[model samples]
Each structure stands twice: as structure tokens, then as C-alpha cells.
Target chain A: MKISEIARLVDANIYCKGNEDTDIRCAFACDMMSDVLAYVKNQAILVTGLVNPQVIRTAEMMDIPCVIIVRGKEPTPLMLEIAADRGITVMNTKLRMYSVCGILYNHGLPADEGE
Target chain B: MGALHLEYTVAPDDFSRAGEVSGIVKRTLKDLGFPPAVVRRTAIAMYEAEINMVIHANGGKITADITPEEIMIVFADQGPGIPDIDLAMQEGWSTASEDIRDMGFGAGMGLPNIQKSTDYMDVQTTVGVGTTITIKIFVTQ
Candidate 1:
């Protein structure tokens, strides 16, 4: 799915105009940066309620093109700066994490491909 | 032969800057055209250690030696060291404060995740003294 489509699907606000055109095949939703780092696959979108620099750092390390902040949380200035600097698309939704995951998963975004 | 050497001092609770060193090292590896897998694993391992330094140790210094064969990252800290290595290495063991948990870490996944990303990992710790972790990731075709 595309970033714009996911944003519309989850009712999120796009905080970065990065390469949203990048088609993502899977998505990983978790609040733990460790889990995100340990399990995420290439070109995946990270959907989490964790709003911090580590979120963007994890995205950068994993080469994840997009990060969706759920629970109506706001990304810190540092988070936004790094996301923009790294060319990562950052978005946020009022929907909670489980809901966020369900919506995206129902939209044909692969949740997990079994490692 | 010895290759690139990098060092950085992490400040206590400096959430905004925890991954600076890792980011730089990752970019350097990518610029050098290391395999994508190698670069990503190196970056994740180093970043986890960096976050651990801030969250658990209050702060520390990291030294990295990068060569064609391997990347060795040493994390040295003077915080209250781990009393039990076995417990700390477990996937779900953590001693981090609630504040650390709010940041989306402290779920006891740092050490295990580090081990998962690197080819080899060694931890030397002394209660009340400190801990030094060395992780070496080798480059392979």
C-alpha cells in the first residue's frame, strides 16, 4: 500500500513529504523499539504509539520508509527533524495501535511474513 | 590491518541524541557499499547498545573499529553493573525504570537483540563497578 492510501485508511496526518510513493509490502506494529529492530523486514512501514527518536532511528536502521504514530501521539521536534533528514515518511493517527494495525492489515498490507 | 576507528561519549538521559553515532557509522558503511545486510545488522546492533548506555548506564563511551573483515564495537560504562549475566541476557529481563519504558524501550530486549544482530557478543560486568560489551560482526559474501 502507499503512504497516502494508508494515511487515508487510518485517518492520519502526514508529517513528512518523503518518498511516500514507495510501495510497502508489509507492516510491523509494535511499541517496543527492540521488537521493531529485531523483527522488521525490508521496506516495511512501522506503526507504533512510541513517539521518540528511537522510532526514527529504528526506521533508519531497518531502512523502513514510513512510520505511523498511533494513539494520537505527537512526534517530538527531534523526531521530525531526523525523519525529514533521513527522508522517512512520518504520520500519526488518533486510532490506537491495535486498531491501526487492523485497519492496515485489512487493507492488504502484509502483517508478518514469518521472519 | 587496522581500519576505521570511531568513538563517542553518550550523555545520561539524552534521548534526542542517542543514535547519533550509529547513524554516522551506518552512513559510512553504506557509502563504502558494504552489503545491505551487513550495514543494517551493524547499524541495529550499534544502535541498541547506544540506547542501552543511555537508559541503563546513564551514559558511556563507545569505540568501534571497522575493517574489511569485521566491525568490533565496544561499549564501556561505569553504571551499576549487571549482577547476573544469565538473567540480563534473557529476552524478557529488564531493570529499566518506568521512565525508560515510556520511551518505548526497557522491555528487556536490548542485549538479546544485540546478540541477534551480531555474529558474536561478549559481556563483562562487575556489580557496582561497570560493564563492557564487545560485539563483533563479520562481513561475508
Candidate 2:
């Protein structure tokens, strides 16, 4: 799935440009960075409400190209700077975490490496 | 092959700056033309080790040696050491404070996750001395 499609489907506001078309190989929804590290195996989109620099660090390490900040939570400036530097598309949606994940899952995005 | 050595000092308890060194090494791996899968594994392992240094140890120094066959990263910290390596290695066991968890870490998955991402890993510790963790990843993996 393209990153822009996620943004449109979830009613999200993309904070970074030029990465709208980045291919999202999978999706994982969790605020726990450790779980993301332990489970995410490939290019996955991180759906989380946690707004911190470590989130970006996690994505960067995992090579996750997109991060969706849910519950209308926007990322901090430092997070945005890091995401921009790392070429991660940061998107924010007003929908709760569960709804956002359901929408993406319904759209045929695999939740884990097994799929 | 001869390895390229790189070093960075981690400041204790600085959650904000914890993973900077790992990030740099991750980028360096890419610049050196490593495969994405191998690069991501190394970076994630190193990142976890680096964060553990800040949260558990009183911060530490990370030295990485990069070679065509493997990348080795050593994390040495001067803080209260791990009393039980077995427990520390267990999943869902952690001594991190609530503050650390609030920062999105301290899920007790650090060491285990590091082991999963690396081809080789070793841990050495003493009660008062500190802890040292070395993780190696093969390039051909």
C-alpha cells in the first residue's frame, strides 16, 4: 500500500512531503517501541499514539517508512526533524488507535510478517 | 577482512539522546553498501543495547567495528550490574522505572531482542562494577 492511501483512508494529516508514495509493506499498531522491535520484521507502518523521539528511532532502526500518530496526537518537533531526516512519512489521525488499525487491516495491509 | 572502528559515549539517563549512536551506525551501514535486512537487524540490536545502557547502566560507551563479513558492537557501562542474567534475559521481566516506560521503553525486551537480531551475543556483569554486552552480526546473513 502507498503511504498516501493510508493517510487518505484514515483521515490523517501528513506532516512530511515527498514520501507520500512510499510503499508500506506491512503495518503494526503499538505504542511500545520494544514490541515493535521484537515483532516487526520488514517495512511496516507504525501506528502509535506515543509521541517521542524514540518512536522515530525505532522506525529508523526497523526501516519502517511510515508512522501514523493516532488519537489526534501530533509528533514533537524533534520527532518531525528526525522523521524528515530519515525520510519517514509522519501522519496524524483523529481516529482512535483501534479504528485506524481496523481500517488499514481491512484494506489488505498485513499486520505482521506472517501475512 | 580488516574492520573499521567507530566509537560513541552515551550519557547516563538521557533518554532523549539514547539511540543517537545506533542511528549513526545504521546510516553508516547503508553508506557502506550493506543490505537493508542486515543493516536493519544490526541497527535494531545496537539501538536496543544503547538504550539499555542509558536506562539500566549509568550510560556507557559503544564501539563498533565494521567489516565485510561482520559488524561487532560493544557496549560497556559503569553502573550497578545485572544480578541475574537469566532473569534479565527473560521476556516481560524488567526493572525500568515508570518514567522509562512512559518514554516507550523498559519493556524488558532489550536483551532478548538484541539476541534475536544478532548472530552472536555475550553479556558480562558484576554487582558493583558494570555490564558489558557485545553483539555481532554477519554481513552475509
Report the number of the highest-TM-score candidate: 2
Error of 2 at B77 (Å): 0.3
Backbone clash pairs for candidate 1 read none
Candidate 2 segments exceeding 4 Å error: none
Measured over all alpha carbons after superposition, the RMSD of each candidate to the real structure, in angstroms, is 1.7, 1.4
User: With candidate 1 superimposed using the best TM-score fit, by how many Å does residue B9's alpha carbon deviate from the native?
Assistant: 1.3
Give TM per candidate: 0.94, 0.96
- Residues B1-141, model 1: lDDT tens digits: 449998988888788789888999999999877889899889999998999888888889999898988889999999889999899889989998898888788888889989988999999999899999999989973
Misplaced by over 4 Å in model 1 are: none
lDDT of residue B72 for candidate 2: 90
Candidate 2 residues B1-141, lDDT tens each?
467999899998788888999999989989989888788889889999988988888798999999999899899998899999999999999999998899888899999999988899999999999999988998886
Q: Which candidate is the best by lDDT?
A: 2
What CAPRI class is candidate 1? medium
Clashes of 1: 0
| Local error of candidate 2 at residue B11 (angstroms) | 1.5
